[model samples]
Target: MNFVKRAGMSLRARKSRTAALLGIFVVICALLLGGFLLRSAAEGREAAAQRAIGVDVTVRKKGMSAADAGRLGALDVVHRYNPRFPVRAGADGFAALTSRRPAPGGARAGGGGPLAVVGVRDAGLLLPFSYGSTGITSGRGITPADAGRHVAMVEERLAAENGLKVGDTLRVRSTAGTRTVPVEIVGIFADPTRDPTGAAPPHELPGNVLYVPVRTARQLGSPGTTGEAVYRVGSPDQAERLHAAADTLLGAGSFDFRVNDKAYRDQVRPIQRVGAFASLIVLVIAVAGALVLGLLVMSQIRERRDELGVLLSLGERKWKLVGQHAVEVAALALPAVAVAAVAGQLAGPAAGAALPGGGSQHRRAAAADGVDATVPPPDPRVEPADVARVAGVGLGISLVATVVPGIGILRLHPRSILADTE
Candidate 1:
């Protein structure tokens, strides 16, 4: 019989040994496939979280002149920049609309309570809008055309409470009560944390917030009043580089650059940990599987020594004997590898989901970004490249395990083996 036929016969005769080797190959392949899939998913999730949190730097300093804002906006790393002019103002008209009477001495009902009047060229580019913490729900957001106009975008809850709508006028009194700016309500926005039980402070409620053009804010406050400028970078990974660039351009002591990457870091932590653990598991399983399978093959080879000796006595080449053993192991492992690929595809995502710390941190990060929806499941298919990789490694392990012991076939003396067996 040819070496191929002999290999088939050997496998048929050693059913238990063949089954054991097949099972080991399946486990190794399954681990490899699952690990690769999990790592891919983790990386994708980390990147998405980073993008959701955004990469922005806030320059908080007094006297951020228009010239300085212009220079910062021109930086190559800056995707966009919005210089805010925040001031405190009383909107008694809105207060009265909410059915709250004035205080004892005729002060506004909310204790002459000041609402946050934020001035910007474009409300869409501001942190709240950019981070998705708030979004325009009615009319239109502040535009460049409204830069010097008395236009405003009030919060939805505030507008509802005051019965304000688009085209209505909001009378705002400056902090010193010296100037009253009447801004046209052009839009309304919804706050992510609009619930009464939300974590925002009483004074910082979305209902007490208003947006106006930068010029209007200047008109209501000191012309020289300076507010913070926020710069949006290209990505989270580039935040530090952009920070250094900003410091170099604007001078280190002149401005304090605060980069808010905490959300991104927190979200990515669990994914990174899971990825590392999966990698380590893959490595351990591959190495250990090889060692265990090799030893088992060595023992099987020893048990078949008398048979190999007879083959050698029949003039079969030693290398052919080794090739026959290799072919048998390959045949046994190929089917197991295929089954493992399917198993990994079906189970990899579930395995990753079950890993500790994967979901909770991601949810918290999403909430920080004002996202309250369920995250969709990751793709579960095993890619062709991953299958190819597992196959290559599995084959390598099988060859090393089988060939190392198959070498003993060359040392087999037909007379010694036949006499020993007898």
Candidate 2:
């Protein structure tokens, strides 16, 4: 009789053991399928979060402090924070970007309007920088980490006029000449925005603009005095939270907490975190599944020593004995794979949302920033590829569990096996 046919008969004879192993295989396969489905849903949620990051809000208060800005930025709902402090400063060495012709009324003497130096925590979070209307031509823009540092991003045309490059130093003095701050040029940006009427002040020229750290700007004229605090939040819900926080911190009826529902393109950091977690689930289940099946198969091989000896004594080849065992495992694994595919399809939606950054998390990303509507969670459909992946992992687990243990028993002589059963 063919080993394949014989293996089928043997499984029927040991119905209890065969049913137990089949149940275990089905569980392992189901988890593998669930992991793949969850990962797909996470990717969809991340895409939605990217689209949702543009909702913005600005809180304007008189004499807002740096401490207040820092505390507001620390909120999880705030995606990006920019505290703007615009001040006029006198340039020491470099020439400001000026018009060939003076103002129509002829500019007043004494160079009253100094260069415009704006202080910020994250320059990139500002309007011009975030929208690409203004872009860094060289080096990197100032980030939140540059707080308290004397780093700055010089305007492109202004840097070229002074023959300045990154790592060069520029000097700025307060309008009252009470204090001077020396700033290191870490980046140079270009802006096409110009005074259409050419009637703007010298300091207000687009080319003469300078971006410095928030702390550095505080030293120019006002200590801890910011013009306004702007934030990029994922939803209107987050914007409301910011409004409440600002009222508690800056007091009520004094500040203008305005929320702009317009979408602003920014970074989606939480999506990356969600993907990492899905990968961890896949890895943990795969490793544990292999270990469990291996131990069970090894124990079964030891108990079947008498059956193995009879097969070998009847002229069945040692390799065929191993093949029969492999056939039995494959028979169970194939059915389990089918069962898992069905189970995953039925349970995918509920399970996907249950994952981190999935269900209620989707609500934060669902609406059009301010539009209150319930958006359905990303579909975690069990695709053909996902089934294929689970199938491959199941076969791999079976190979390791059966082949490794079978090889160990196959090495013993048939006489040694028969004598052991006696």
Predictions in order: lDDT? 0.73, 0.77
Clashing pairs in 1: none
Model 1 clash number: 0
Q: Tell me the alpha-carbon RMSD of every candidate.
A: 6.8, 13.1
Task: Estimate the TM-score of every prediction.
Answer: 0.69, 0.56
Q: Please report the candidate that would top TM-score against the real structure.
A: 1
- lDDT per residue as tens, model 1, 229-279: 877664665777766766777677777777765554555566678878878
- The reply for model 2, stretches above 4 Å from the true place, is 1-36, 39-55, 109-113, 260-422
Lowest summed lDDT window (length 10), candidate 1: 96-105
Error of 2 at 287 (Å): 28
